[model samples]
Target: MNEREVLSNYVYQIVASLVASGVEQVVVSPGSRSTPLAYAFASTKELTLHRQVDERAAGFYALGLAKATAKPVVLLCTSGTAGANYYPAIVEAKYARVPLIVLTADRPHELREVGAPQTINQVRLYGENVKWSAEFPIPDEAPQTLPYIERHTVRAVTIATTAPFGPVHLNIPFREPLVIDFKTQLQRVSFVKSFTNDLTPSKQTLAEFTSIIEQTKNGIIIVGELPLGTDTKALWNFVRELKWPVMIESLSNLRTEVPEDCQVFAITTYDALMKNERFKRNVRPQTVIRFGAQPISKFLMQFIAQSNPLHYIVIDEDPMFRDSTHSSTHFIHALPGEWLSEIEISHVETELAYIEFWKTADLLAADAIAKYGQTANDEGAYVQLMLESLHEGTDIFVSSSMPIRDIDTFLPVLNNDIQVFANRGTNGIDGVTSTALGFSNGRANRKTYLLIGDLAFLHDANAFVASRYQDCDLTVIVLNNDGGGIFSYLPQAKVEAHYEELFGTPTALAFEQVATMYDMEYVKVTSKEQFLATITSEKQQSLKLIEVFTNREENVKEHRALWTRINEVIEQWLDML
Candidate 1:
């Protein structure tokens, strides 16, 4: 067989194997070294290929896609720094438990450390962020490296798609003999099942956990971030029926059936209460029931530590350190849905006044949210309006910093069906745009919205270069307070003007320039009126950039003013009683 035929067959075999192994979306970054692999992925009809120029953005884009789909996303890049560019997303995938399969093409070992163009250490470049890492040797016609490639690809994808799922690395070192023909038929191989089957906990494990829950009173259930399709409704019903003081994280998806009696504090909102003596004493339950991923709050962590609950039950399939509560008593290695079904709801006695205490606190919070709504310029009001305008089942990828916090605090989820995602594990602004783009890959049938900040969007501007979201009805609403709006609410802002220059770091880039560059539909709104009008408008074929402009300093003042008013109202209401 000709050399091109051999390589083409190799390509066909690789792509077919990936498709058979359940890899759906493959993100390909353009480069000469990766031409064969790119063509292989794009040529196949079974797989979807999202073409991106910037490798860094492409990597995060794949991360976002995998996160939303709960499937393994394949990332293809050429030799050199292209592979290195994926490191950040790889770290996020590992920490966030998203499945990412990285395929990096490299020159043979002979080309390494010898002034070779676009070449570096491709071996284990991702550090501890990858679940598994392997390098495929140069294929020789006789006993070809096809078997090795197939085995590693299968294992990497399997590990990434299973529980505690994470990113995996595969480096293919090819020589001059790497060229392939288009028409050659490559030999195929069966995909090996590499999933971990020990997900079912033993009977003894269930009994031990049941004993803890039965004996514990004054317990609190803290649900953090959960995986997609993990059956949150069943868990929500169980917690509600149990009448436990459950602290629901925004990403937990446990906010759907929240009871109106108000034992649930909406802890993400009243962050300042963590420091208040009366607030802590009144709201801190004796135990905590944690059942999701890590939350986005340092104040809550401190509160958990200081309040020091008697016990904290973290029920999750994966045993991860969910928080710094420093009091995880029971790590139930079973799915929340599984565990909740076995236990029946029962009445437990604590400080009997605890329920009423939280009830008063919830009323205080509701009143504060209502009053804060009057000021349409603040972060809370912005979140309220944005969420109210969105429809059910809209996939929203929230940027980590302030946008997520504000949503957690002020926005009442209009629809429980609206899927929400964020790079919460790393919580960095970089690649947020790319991540959203990656998530738009297979969503031609659905609408995807991105709630981001001005700075975060600017951080990954290159992501909009060539978007595949044109058919996906994608919209990006950028809250342009010009900088880190959330930082103004932090203690650093109290230090004076230095806060603006050092921490907030406001910028004045026009969103129109970016929209024009991408040939996307754009709208700039300076008030709530324009925002609502644009949000309610019909969805378009092109991606839409809705920029809401506000002053950073003023936004901060507004947030602080709202908090002060909340404290005052809560105090006066208590006095009336």
Candidate 2:
């Protein structure tokens, strides 16, 4: 076989192995060096190819697709800075545990350090962010080359989807004639690798855990960021059996999954009520059990640190240190669903005083939030209204800064079937719009909603390119505070000298123009009633945006006032107790 034949067969085997290993979607960025891969992926009948112009946007798009589908999505890009653009998404996939297979095309071995155009050190480019990295040899007719390519591709897919799943990088080097012209019969390769492992806990460990739970009268369960397709039913059963107060994060998906009758144990307003020292003193958990990633609420973290529970247990499948407060006393290396399923809990009769206290406090906080809804221009109230108005089985993608914080703090106890997602791994505000669009593409049947702040929406404006081409339903709600509204809540707001110039970076671009340029329906609402009507309207297009304008300073005041009202309600409840 000639060099071209060898290269063609190698590329064909790689794509075939990926398909055989169950990779359904591939996001490709146009580039010269990646011509072989682009054509191979396009020609494959089993793979769905998505073309993206911007490499950065493509990276997050693939990440979102993988996240939504709970499968490994392939990413193809050219060499040089194009591959580097995937760094943000790779970092997020690393911590967020999304499965992605990143393939970057590169020059041959002889071109290293020769000042060749578009040539850079692409070996192990993502470094620690990727679970594994490999440099592929130039395609040749060696006797063992085909087997090596097939095995490598299979291993990459397996590792990417294994326990503590994450992104994997494979740098492919191609010589001249990057394109494939002749049609050749592709060879079939078998994927014989097994990546599944049973993580059943030992009997002693379960007995010890049962003892801990039995001994503790006042305990709390904090649920944080969970991976896609997590067995939320198992978690709900475990928490229900424990019969403790549960503080669920917005991304936990448990916040909305909690049944209506169980609202007494579900503490959705802990962020507001934790600010009251009197409430904290009256209802602090003696033992705290946490699951999944770090919580998004800063107040919750502070509360955990200050409480200094006797037993702070963290259960995670990954080995990473998810505790930012460094307060975890025991770390259980086990899958949450598997562990909870194995442990058998019997009914235990204990004093109902502690649980009743937390239930009363939660009710008081819920009442406080209900009263706050009478005021307009409040972001927290808007979040509550938005969530309440969403239809069952809606998918909401929240931006990192204030939008996610608001949802975390004030989102009510919902019984609707809703899934909330965010890029909380690194928590940067870039590529949010693209990620949401990709998620919509993956789950084409679901109606998607993206709640983004003005700055984040503007930063990822280019994401509209994909939205224009892809046929998906997305309702984008832009919270336009005219500046970095989150900065006003920080301590730097007191720095009256340069706060506006430095932290409050305001942009004057009209979002209606953006909507026009992107061929989206735009509606600017000045009142809460209009905002609710616009969001809940049935006349939304393929891509629609609703812009809500508010004052940054007033937002800060509203948050403070909401907290004060919550404190008063809690104090009143305590007086009755």
Instruction: Specify the highest-lDDT model's number.
Output: 2
> For this target, which candidate reaches the highest TM-score against the unseen true structure?
2
Please, what is the TM-score per model?
0.92, 0.97
Task: Tell me the spans in candidate 1 whose CA falls farther than 4 Å from its real position.
Answer: 257-275, 344-353, 413-416, 468-472, 573-577
Query: Scored by Cα lDDT, where does model 1 land?
Result: 0.74
Clashing pairs in 2: none
> lDDT, candidate 2, residue 189?
88
What are the Cα lDDT values of the candidates?
A: 0.74, 0.85
lDDT of 1 by residue, 401-459 (tens): 88888777665423346656788878898999888877766555567888899999999
Looking at model 1, report the run of 10 residues with the lowest lDDT sum.
261-270
Candidate 1 TM-score versus the reference: 0.92
